[model samples]
Target: MRRGARYRWVVLAVATFTQAASGFFVQGIGAMGIQLQRELGLSTAQLGLLVSAAQFVPLVGLLVAGELLDRCDERWVVGAGAGVVAVALGAGALVPGYAGLLAVLLVVGAGYSTVQPGGSKSVASWFHASQRGFAMGVRQAGLPLGAAFASAVLPLVAGAFGWRAALVTGGFVALLGAVAFMTLYRRPPGRAVLPRARTPRGVRMRLLREPAMVRTMLAGAGLISVQCGVGILTVLYLHEVAHAGAGAAALVLVATQGTGVLGRIALAAWSDRVGVGRQRAVVVCMVAVVAGMAVLLTPAGRSAAVACCAFLWLGFFGFGWYGPWVAQVTESAPPDRTGFALGLAMSVNQIAIVAVPPLLGLLKDLSGGFAPAWGLLIAMTLAALVASVRTGGARRSADPAPDRDEVACPS
Candidate 1:
């Protein structure tokens, strides 16, 4: 039991680092907004498209990865996916034009799709319900932690050496993640000794109909949109509107990601203590994000001190919201099909991530300011929050979840 406990921590560490390493580049791209725009002569929309390109393939790829995870071990599936990201970014580093970079990122997205569900399921398997929320938060916090490091470092590399060098930096880190995962990750002790079985057909379809799933989808869509908006625009907004220097703006972006890291861990830890009512925590995040964006939409946010505080607030709630939300998903998921549930929830989120960055950028480009873009996200999040609240009540008034045997694995 002690060996297993220690090994579970090892699993958590590897899973967390892999999450960070795999996402380092894409998540940090927003901080590189100034460099990419200058070196490549990219418009706001074009810069946003870079993130979109990386996210595009994940839309369908996540669903496929979910199926793969239910059938195979996470070690191979996740490691191979991270390897693809490392190669795509590293090799594509020297591409001469923007179009080629986008093509390369599409491949990166394909590889990254496997990592999310794979890592989540791996942690879920090792940790039980009592500790899972906190464990998942620590694992999920890797995204922002990696992004924060990348935000600080990648921008400097892009500014000093060139954007291509930054690509190499991200890829090298991803390679480390791939190697670590393949070498270190193992299924829970007993499960590895048993024969593997496939998750039954229609698992994904049935998951879509669950009340918990509806909340997950709604919450994920809204918060993911906010997360992308924050990443792609924070540096640019600070530099352009607030008249901060390049380095100062980058630092602010780093701070935002830093807060995001704290939010993920703290909120998740909170959920672990709260038991089954995690959605209330998500609602609080939504309300907080809405408040921060409302500030940004007004003149009060024009002050540097105020703007910084608002972004930090947005970072905390907007990014932090996922910990509890994802915990809720795992909490509600059928034990055997946690991977499929995670994949299904995340795939729904991929739609917003792929679509939001470019659209928000376009909104900024068209309106010639950040207000319109902020307003749109404010609207999106508010809508989702309202829907979540209504659905929660209706769900309580409705019938209970069906038995697990109805969705059991193949015998």
Candidate 2:
């Protein structure tokens, strides 16, 4: 399949669905946070740990899964990974205890490591440079949209039939994703199934040595940190610092999330239409996120309306940054090493995802104010922006034909 082929759209839709389904169970943990706390006699930190446990394994699992993708077909790699997610989460419903549930979510994270990079590689296979940004954007959007949907429904399922039922429901959704991807996804017509390109050590060194990859990882870490800050701190800042009502502060978080979804799609599409290439698009998002985070430090941020707008701005570029950044990673990947490159870059990002929120929270606790946390994020982002500028254009010749993988096939 090629971008012009109708089946490419099918690939995009199925890949997007798989991304959503893969995350549905994990996202549900947050949705039913209170219920999990009450039924399990858990502390708030333990409840937070469930979400972390579900994500923690991906820190290493993604690289392993990415290597497998290069050797095998995505239909099988992603399908099997999704299948693992389905089975683990389904089995989790019967665990009935906190420790067991934590272990199960760990397994879910292991399985889920495949969905992100695998899905990106699949889309990159079908869509050329001209359209890859838009396709990647749409595919990335599925994650938040799916989480939002789970936020709405899984809580109800947990409320009515108990949390076990919610786990089962999420497992079913993941199963559907596995089946859909395996049943519908196809390789771009002329693209060959590549062999193991190199050893894991070799791959790691090669990618790390690439200037573009380094820049991508740096920017990704910084931007995702801002994303984590936006999600974890927005409501708290509005409620405690701005003197806004709890419900109103929460509504602002909702707007931030909703705007994030739109931003993912819109920003990625902009990269597609612009002639400046994906790297510039990613830098633009970085600039915007930096601007948004900096505003939180000023007196103007104390106004409820202004704080709400700032978070929305942060949400748009912070959460929206992934699409173009991922595109840049895939595009800059070594020949036939897109999956590993994507995985490696994202695993680096996972470090930020795991660390930033807690670090920011710790900063807030120690300082007795949110300003320190906000300033920390601004510094992180600005540092990355500066590093990116300093390292710019060093890899352009090596990265000349990013669309070299674009293959034409008969419809």
Candidate 3:
């Protein structure tokens, strides 16, 4: 293989590993929910808040991380950010109460805000347009892969050593990821070597106004809501509604997340061959999510075997959609602004990620069942499907004019 080709794969491997490590603790939280409630005396909302607190800082931090990636080497930005995550989680192991855990997670979120955009930027820099979707899929798969690993392990750790030890173990894993990334990562050859400079506020605001950008943000709001709901509520729902044991319920979450890893890769590779490409792939995933949620509402879905299948389907489509969706966002940006575009788009997603979990938990608390929560996801995903079709068609016609300022980068 050519040296450039070989190096890009190396970059992909590093990006995937670091992303997995960074997300380890947060992803495991759902599996530990029952344990946390038992030990910490957490109400449903409080448990949901623990998830939301990690996401809250990303609303702004992603924008900053995006801007930094546009200016600096991803090696420093991504590596240092993962280091911060490790440090914060390590600190969290010693904190005394729910409030203290929330404070530590806020810091972890601040650090993590850098990892997603930074890893995407790094991988996007290395791959060409033709293969970018697949590459992005593999990179984004890290989250679910990390969550799967966490789901399998963290609950067991909490069971034996307590939840604090699980947090500490996650910290060590993140620390190793940081060291590996910093040691091995390099910038793609022939990319611009400009002095670090901020993206102008005017330029940032203008990118937000682009049709593709607006559509992506809106779609992300709904899709991410579904994803967050599945992440935070799936185990709880299975335990409470399906009468599954905590271990079985946690394993269901693991199955869902594990399937998501394959879903991202498969869907993204499919995008590379499709007619309308990534946007259409996202729409298809949305439709699948709606169908999956609808299945959850049916009587057949109450059967443990069927309910597991339903959630596995939701995991595949709901979480899998991000690969193509993110590919579309990166492709939509002007070459120089991919990082900013991703950051801006994901920052919008942060709103949904932070709000959905607690809100869904509230719905469950009020209704005394999972039906309302599943219905809400179904409705949200259906709306996103409609928006994607309309905006995607419109974007093709409007694409030539709105992005006149964008200069295509050499591949």
Identify the leading candidate in terms of TM-score: 3
- Cα RMSD of all models vs. native, in order, equals 3.6, 3.1, 2.8
The number of residue pairs in model 2 that clash at the backbone is 0
Each model's TM-score, in the order given?
0.94, 0.88, 0.95
Q: What TM-score does candidate 1 get on C-alpha atoms?
A: 0.94
Off by over 4 Å in 3: 397-411
Distance from true location, Cα of 155 in model 1, Å: 0.9
lDDT of 2 by residue, 1-411 (tens): 234588888899999999999888676455465566668886534654676677788899988888888899998999999999999989988896889888998999889999999999999888767778888999998776676667567767887898889889999999999999999988887777867765468768978988888888999989888876776566568867899864466556666767777888999999877765677878998889878877888999888888888988877888887788888888788757778888899899888876675577667766888888888888999999999878786864254264454462224
Determine which window of 10 residues in candidate 3 has minimal summed lDDT: 400-409
Candidate 1: residue 393 Cα off by (Å): 1.9
lDDT of each: 0.86, 0.80, 0.86
The candidate, 2 or 3, that scores higher on lDDT is: 3
List the candidate 2 regions with Cα displacement exceeding 4 Å.
1-4, 28-48, 96-98, 158-163, 197-200, 235-252, 297-304, 364-369, 397-403, 406-411
Q: Candidate 1, overall lDDT? A: 0.86
Which residue pairs does candidate 3 place in steric collision? none
Clash pairs, model 1 backbone: none
Worst 10 residues of 2 by lDDT: 402-411
lDDT score, candidate 3:
0.86
lDDT of 1 by residue, 1-411 (tens): 567666888899999999999999998889998889989999999999999999889888988898788778899999999999999999988788899889989999999999999998888777766566788889999999999999999998998999999999999999999999999998775564234466566766777878778977898899999999999989888888888888998898899998998999899888877744677788889999999999987888888888899999988988998888887887667766667788889988989998898999999999999999999999999999988887786552121133322221111
